[model samples]
Target: MIIKTPRLKKGGAKNVYLENVSHAVTRPAMESRRVQMYLLMLLADTAVLLGSFVLAGGVYRDQWPNEFAMAMGWAFLPIFLVIAVYQRCYSIRALDEVRYAIGQAGIALVLSAMLCTVMIFYAKAATEFSRVMLSLALVAAFAGMALVRVVMHLVLRRIYGPSVSSVLVVMDGGPKVDIRGAQIVHAEDFDISGVQSSPNSLDRIGRLMRGMDRVVVSCAVDQRTKWANVMRGAGVRGEVVSTALQELGAIALEREGGQSFLVVSTGPLALHARIFKRGMDLAITVPAVLVLSPLLLLVALLIKLEDGGPVFFVQQRMGANNCLFDMLKFRSMRVEKLDSKGARSTSRDDDRITRIGRFIRKTSIDELPQLLNVLRSEMSIVGPRPHALGSLAGEKLFWEVDADYWQRHALKPGLTGLAQVRGYRGATETENHLKDRLEADLEYIRNWSILRDIKIIFATARVLVHPNAY
Candidate 1:
């Protein structure tokens, strides 16, 4: 027998996918300049604020800023900058619109004035500072900031062509859609960076996204999942035109040529929002664990006393990005060498469930240990529920049942989720059950807010008594 080995192509499949596109535009220089622009804008805004303070002092007291007045005005600088950052005023996206800049500046002005009032009251300095001058300063701050922004915007427009955002448009099968500031790039063009998706047509759009402002995905409804997963992984600002986005309500609708399309942008959570969400998680989870310590101890004792087995169960569960982490639960089933994949879905009145397990599972008290997981950052307080690797619906694995199943893992797994609150919890037997759960998860991801998370948490309390949980 003659031994023969095939020679491997150089650069591998990735290089092959990337080789077609030669004119790959990278945005590092533009991005660096944009940062410089943000800094320059901040400096200009500071000058306007100081000028407003001086004007207010002169108007109110017939003098330029005194030492105390200057001190007060300078003190407002850090506060103003903090509020501006929290409001994302310096963000490139914020600069995209004049209204956005004015709104953010107004908010910062109001907040700064409110903080000044509170500080003066608390420090017993209200009698020292001129209230009328302070009021004028507040008004002037807003007016001055807005004026500065308008001037800077006009100047920048003249200098740099308005900094209009560009997007890469990827079309699957649809009438030619014209998007402003978008370049249509074929998936077959590999001279530019492209994402090789299917065997027939590679998803070259990924390669073209380097310096692009955003990506507009217009594909068949069935192919939405594929595009969504790709964009989610890319961590790029993207918008998908889908009828499903109409669920996001009137705000997401864009009308073109009397035709309405639901446009959903996959921008990452704002820094302040992310901080607020994480703060909420820590706020609730920390105190709940502390206050419920006795109850947790009681549950642990019950699990231990039932069959002299381990009180806590640690099992691997899929978390964000399909990463596995050891998830904790109060031991609710009979201690045995069971499959880790949760191959055997727990049905109502299952024999594997111990006496204590039956009670805990029904009330969802068994999930309380996951609060530690929340504290550890392995999970979130409100997100899609994680599942075991072997978790299945009927005879097939969960991912095998639906292509979009892994998308749920894009967010951290939670102790409870939108699916549970919507009555889609417990053993998923049919494909429809899984689909319902997936839909709820996707909806949660799309519409996540601090208020929505609070609502889900409140809704989960009602679901704890749900009869289907067991």
Candidate 2:
């Protein structure tokens, strides 16, 4: 018997899979240099740490470590490993920022030394744990780590000979950039007149991005978001040729002749940061739900009593990775003919809102039910706000208005976000309004921290009754 497989459509899932495999097989050998550098640094760090212990033992006592000191040295390995993870000592971006790497390593070493001290004190073995020796070891560890990093940076630079990233240029009838030592694999002749009507532009971008390290988009201000979305979805760092790049803090700058290029880091948060963020979410969400349980119940009762409609409004919303999930909210509209497409934006004087809905919407009480969504791990307490499937800015759908709009979904949708807290909430009036919202969302992702999340939470109280919430 013979069987036939379905034909793969262009740019379809099967095609994307095959293209990914091809790119993997054909990518330049230099692509893995970053990973190789990371391993080399790790090994170098370990060697220096061990040497630090040996030097400390000899300098402090003129002899090798005793049994307890040897045990402490071995114990330091796993403790330091955990500390390094929290400190992001091994992050790839850390390699790019030597100062950051040194600071993180210092923090890790101090944390590990503290743990050793605590363990020694707990066992009542402080007499055997020499404070002078331990202090010397800690100092040596920090100095050795910093020295290794500086040496490795020099070595890698000499070996690699001034790293030049490969970039794809997407400019709509703009002057070409002259970047030295950088490879321009593809340059699309984008036309501003055709951008809006042309549907295949993104498809062309996807094809051009194969084996590319970065994408450079030089387009009109209006079309920036569209290209940004495309580069983000293609999973490459996106750099726009505009003065706005300078406004974004701490971006790398590359200069060649008279022209300068801004390097954007479009990748997801560091692994350690993501884990830490998720941990923070659970730590806050779990207790928050428990504390707000009574208020949640009361809100539900009020919704149920008002006109006897469904107590909760469950709508399909875009979540992390552009996945769809049912987002929960207290019903905030009169159960009239609801717009299944959610194309209509609510206005202050609009009559679809119920009496209770008006108060809930004003007080942001309608969003409380999303705590349940947070508890289920479908959302975070702080992230980019999710939009309903057919949510609109004007006549066009949200995604239709700006291509990069989907990038906001890279992080799980939140109950409150940077955009919401900054008064970008309520109905989006123009394309620029939605674009600004995306900017805020991306900013949050770029600078995410546990402290930032806490700060946003506290700051949210000030914007709970925002002018735009209606």
Candidate 3:
């Protein structure tokens, strides 16, 4: 994880010697300061919210405390916290920039206060709390929170030396990079490779990335995928330097020191967004399963009676992050003719399908068992549909159709997706057929929202018995 300067030999030749330099490069004392700062800012904002209302109460009514004012503060605190988190008020960027921190905090406070006032008015509790006191509290709270952030920013910069976040740049046979304030290490010096399988190599890489908030890798095009795999589980913001304008599945572009880098790995959704999506999934799936239990049982029984084979067909499909998972479905093919790899596309009047199998496939009853996958978190109620590993488009695999095909796996595969609702389902007969679905899938990922997901679920009802199902 450490590097030493190449020493010159007695004959005036440069001889490069690499050794463990852990003792030479000291680890930052505030390695976990990012989390600490987030907690500190949250607590500071809460304290300010309560304290401001208390102070306002004393000023407005000549009382040291007011019950209504305290209640208002408590109600407003949660709203403010939620808004602030969504606005990135306590993020690393906010921590480093005083103006950004203050602006986001102020906006969050304003929005929360407005929402609280509206709620109180609707609840008919406006008569209990004075408008003048509420206004005063809002003003005081905004000023207090902004002041706290400014002070925190200055303190963090002083304590952590200019940048609160640590960035590590690993150079591995790519262009030389000079990132200001970033610790640079030669990948060769440490014998690092994206395809490396040694435990010691992985451990050393982990040690090098211990205190980093972001790790950037500069490697050859062939090594990008390997490095990406390594960084996906590295527990940090990972980027790969590339000259190409677009890289497969890049989430964003980062420019540093007149050079561009592709942000290859990041959580697709923010924390709050992920919570909302998951909540929606559970809210719908749990009840759907309970309500349709009778129908599900009937179908399972029919399939079992039709064939003495397994009732459910479980095939390995690529899911989020290119990880494979067993995608469940009601077995819709004859037991002896089951194609586990899905190499052959189903055709109308396919002899492999039994009478019940054809009926279920045509009605999409075969897909109902995947609701269990949604419950297992291996799939979502709405996302890009996961494909069988051997599924093909015009004799080529799905991924082989386009490089960005893997990008669709950024989110959990869904029970029904935008592509399916738009009638892009069934056997992909050509490359263009796959491309059409791929475009819709990528579009869905790029503009994902709870509302859109709900719409897709509803639209799917209309396409459940499409002609392509055969």
- Taking every candidate in turn, the Cα RMSD to the unseen true structure, in Å, is 16.1, 16.7, 14.3
lDDT (tens digit, per residue) of candidate 1 on 104-207: 88878888788878987899987887777777877888887788778777876676444545456766654355664455654333322223445323334444
Provide the global lDDT of candidate 2 against the true structure: 0.73
What are the per-residue Cα lDDT tens digits for candidate 3 across 132-245?
887898899889888998898778767765677677777888887666556676665655543367776666666666657778899999989988877875666798887763
Query: Over all chains combined, what TM-score does candidate 2 have?
Result: 0.51
Error of 3 at 91 (Å): 21
**Alpha carbon lDDT at 466, candidate 1:** 81
Model 1 stretches with alpha carbons more than 4 Å out: 1-122, 125-270, 337-339
Checking candidate 2 for backbone clashes, the offending pairs are 229-404
Worst 10 residues of 1 by lDDT: 1-10
How do the residues 252-370 of candidate 2 rate in per-residue lDDT, one tens digit apiece? 77799999876764566779877877788889888888998998888878878988998888888889888999888888887884555567888988789888888889999899888
Ranking by lDDT: 3, 1, 2
Count the clashes in each prediction.
Answer: 12, 1, 0
Error of 1 at 467 (Å): 1.3
